[model samples]
Target: MPPSDAPAPTIRPAAPADLPVLGRLGALLVRVHHDFDPLRFIPATPETERLYAGFLGTQLQEPNVVMLVAERDGEVLGYTYAGVEGNDYMALRGPAGVLYDIVVDPAHRAQGTGRMLLEATLAELAARGAPRVVLSTAERNENAQRLFARAGFRRTMIEMTREVEGDAG
Candidate 1:
């Protein structure tokens, strides 16, 4: 199910009071799409809430980290968490920002909510002197891939993965 309706999100930097909602939205992320089951990625417990809360808190305190929320009518509909990373391996000449997390209420999808969150995150990072932005999503997640591409994200490389020292596969 999607959100009741599209939120006229007032994009801005998140505040302390918004922490609780930020955590909620983070949980809702895996639920937004059927393929994103948190249990499959992490242990199933309330610990996820605590982890998300801590992450949100870090975003609030880190100067190079930007946590943006899309709220309207006193409710947060979506958010994006971005962080700048300076590394010699990256394509950017200087520090580059990576969009770590982005989620819009499933009900609010296709209503510009996701776009708004990205746009705001991009702007925030740009203002902070980031040369470029990057992000990664699951290979099966076509919806998000399209959104990122539409927003000017290009395919730079493919990430190959392998499981080691696990139960015989």
Candidate 2:
């Protein structure tokens, strides 16, 4: 949590000017996940920041997508990215809002920033007519799991992964 003396951050829609910081945060996310399981998560490369920013920039004007940032005194402390998705026959699920990413700068973590971003994102998705919202956390991300559970999300699925061996031709 931030010092009580600190002012609260404001949650608002992300802007073009925020892209550089957003890209840095996105690269942090990649590195953290890669640390958790190098084989499962993609490694952060020199171009990751630019690439991530470019990808998210494309979603800025998407009708069903929402990208938000948490700012305090003109500094962006965190951000979340989400979108409404249609039914997935493979998963046997109906339409829903899928949270793609939620990240807070390491210096700002444990300070209510993540929770604020999540609540704001959920509200945005609900306003967009999503009947339900869903997200997948890294198997090792206990902190996020706790936050999601606290926000009334109940577990519905568990994913399992296995690497393939040499070809059987």
User: Highest lDDT: which candidate?
Assistant: 2
TM-score of 2: 0.96
> How many residue pairs clash in model 1?
2
Cα lDDT of model 2 by residue, 72-160, tens digit: 98999999999999998888899999999999998898889999999999999999999999899999999999999999999999988
Q: Note each model's CA RMSD in angstroms.
A: 3.7, 1.6
Instruction: Specify the highest-TM-score model's number.
Output: 2
For candidate 1, the per-residue lDDT at 80 reads: 88
Where does candidate 1 clash, by residue pair? 2-107, 3-107
Per-residue lDDT over 27-141 for candidate 1, one digit per residue giving the tens place of the 0 to 100 score: 6664443345433344334665566766788779887899888887787778889898897455544568889899876656787889989998998899888899878786778
Segments in model 2 whose C-alpha atoms lie over 4 Å from true places: 167-169
Clashes of each: 2, 2
The Cα error of candidate 2 at residue 68, in Å, is 0.5
